[model samples]
Target: MTTLLEARGLTADRPGDEGPVRVLDSVDLALESGTLTELVGPSGAGKTTLLLALARLLPDARGSLALDGVPAEEIDIPAWRMRVALLPQRPTMFAGTVAENLRVPWRLGVRSAESPPDDTALREALDRAGLSGVALERGATRLSVGQAARVALLRVLLTRPRVLLLDEPDASLDDASAEQVRRFTAEFVSGGGAAVRVSHARSDDAADRRVRLTGGRLEEVGRA
Candidate 1:
């Protein structure tokens, strides 16, 4: 498999009342194309910190990150973020209709040149995310937690990121809804995208690799 994203000596720190708290300790990770990597660890184990470091979203994170073998320093941050999208646990809904919220990516500088998705395309994406009943004109803020999570996921999918950084995407979902989330993740991997998902539940879904984080250190648990 081709290496889609690589990280070496990744380190991160968080702000505390006393001083900076070390969250990650020189962690290294590599993501390959057409694979989904499951990240599991106890609470406060820095699993989410690692994902944030990988996505270059943490201001205190320091490391060497490369995408498709290109050094991160050479690539613009916005461009890198566009290719490597990070979806947090809490879904953020803009103050607008569903269609408008999904169209946010196109309005960003990174996707400015790309043609925005039509209503037909949006509806199809919603259907795939198990949100077909949601109307495009419906107020995005009114969606239930589960519904909002799927919509946020669909919003990320519409951007067509190469590497997806998902932080507990299925935590708020029920069994049926969680299954749909897993299916969407599988489809993304099968389509040649790489994903690093932080999941607490034991997944029956297929994943190429499993990594565990403990005390800011990473250990390989197994591989498919």
Candidate 2:
């Protein structure tokens, strides 16, 4: 598989009320196209930090990141972000309806170059996420956490990002919804998409590699 994303000496820190504290240290990783990589570790082990770094969303991040063999900095921030979509652990929705939220990608200049997914595609994504009851016209705020997560994921998927950085996407999902997530991720990789999923729990989803962190450092590197 071609390398879609790569990081070397990835490090990050958090600025709290007290001061800046280190959260990640010298993390080296690569994400290959057509594969899923699971980032597994204990809580506060920097899993989310790593994911944000991969998506170039962290202000405290200090490291080298490349996309398709090109330095990420060379790419426009907006374009880079759209290509490497990061789904936060707690996804927020717009004040408008679900359909309105789904239409946001088209409103962005960075993403407008690519045609937005049609209503049929959006509805199919929602259905696959087991959210058929979430009418597009329904207020986004009315969604449950699990439903919101799915909706957020579907929104990202509609953008056709080259890489997906998901933070514990299944943490709030029920068994049925979780199954849908697993299936969608698996199929995504199988169809030449790349993704990094942050999860502490071991799941049945297929991943090409496992990157483990402990105490804010790379601890184990294994294949799945």
Candidate 3:
């Protein structure tokens, strides 16, 4: 398979009272098309930071990131963002109805207006995320965190990004909800898509490769 994403000598640092605080140091990763990779680590291990960097959501720091064999900096930010979507650990939802929140990405220009996904596709995506059509009419603030997470997943799916970045996506879910997320993620990658997920959950089966980050470095742990 072709390489969809690659990071070389990636490093990130933040200003501290005394000096620069290094979060990542010479971290490297490669993700192929149609694969799901997991990034597992303890808190503050730079898992989320790496995801952000790969998605081009983070400001320019050090090293290089390439998407579809092209350097990240060479692509337009908005266009790159459309090709790469990130679902943070705590995803934000609008105050409107569930459907409205799901539609926000399309309405905001992530997807082309000329070829928007149909209602059937949207409903199917929600169903795959373990949600029913009733969720569409419900108020976003009224749904529980787990439901919101599923809705967020559906929202991202609607955009059909080639590369997906998820950060602790299953953190607030119950057993059944987590299983739903796993199944959805698996199906997403099965369809010639690529994903990198950051999670501490040991039970997730969506990832084909597992990586561990510690002390500002990343190392491979397992391969599926």
Candidate 4:
């Protein structure tokens, strides 16, 4: 498969009371189309930082990143973001009905109506994310943490991004919900897109290649 995303010598740091604290250093990674890769690490190991950098949400230090054979910096940020979607560990939902929140992107004109997915597509996406269409018409603020996460995932899927970046998406789910997340991720990649997941679960089934990050560096972990 062809490479969908690549990062070379990526690094990040932030100002601290002591000095600059390095979050990521000399990180190199490549993700292929139609594959799901996992970045595993302990807390504060820069897994999220790496994901943000790859999504073009954070600027890296002294490295190059490319998406779909084009330099990341050369692409329009908003367009790049449309192609690469990020689902943060804590997703924010607007104060409205779940369907309203799901339709927020559309209402904001972020997505064009000509290509709008049908109701069945939306329902299927919600179902695959372990949510029912009923939740769509309910109040978003009333959803449990896991339900919120599922809604976030479904919302991103509606955008039809070519690359999906997930940060600990299963952290708040039960076993059954987690399994549904795993299945949906697998199916997403199987459909010719790519995903990079940051997970701590020992038995995650969504990754094909796994890498471990430690002390600001990354090393390949065995196959998933």
Q: Over 4 Å off in model 4, which ranges?
A: 59-62, 112-115
- lDDT (Cα, tens digit) per residue for candidate 3, span 104-130: 877765465546666677677777777
Candidate 4 lDDT over residue span 111-163, tens digit each: 66436556777677777676864555789988888788888888887888889
lDDT of 3: 0.84
lDDT of 1 by residue, 1-224 (tens): 89999999988888889998788888889999999999999998898889888888888688799999999999999999999999998999999999999999998877778999999999999987889799999999999988898889999998999999999998888888888888988999999999999989756468889999987789899899
The residue-by-residue lDDT of candidate 2 on 112-202, one tens digit each, is 6677777888788788778888898899999988788788888887778899888988887887777777887887778787999987664
lDDT of each: 0.90, 0.84, 0.84, 0.83
User: Number of the top candidate by lDDT?
Assistant: 1
Give candidate 3 regions above 4 Å deviation.
110-115
What number of backbone clashes does candidate 4 have, counting pairs of residues 3 or more apart or in separate chains? Answer: 1
Candidate 2 achieves a global lDDT of: 0.84
Error of 1 at 217 (Å): 0.6
Instruction: Give each model a TM-score.
Output: 0.96, 0.92, 0.93, 0.92
Model 1: weakest 10-residue lDDT segment is 199-208
Better of 2 and 4 by lDDT: 2
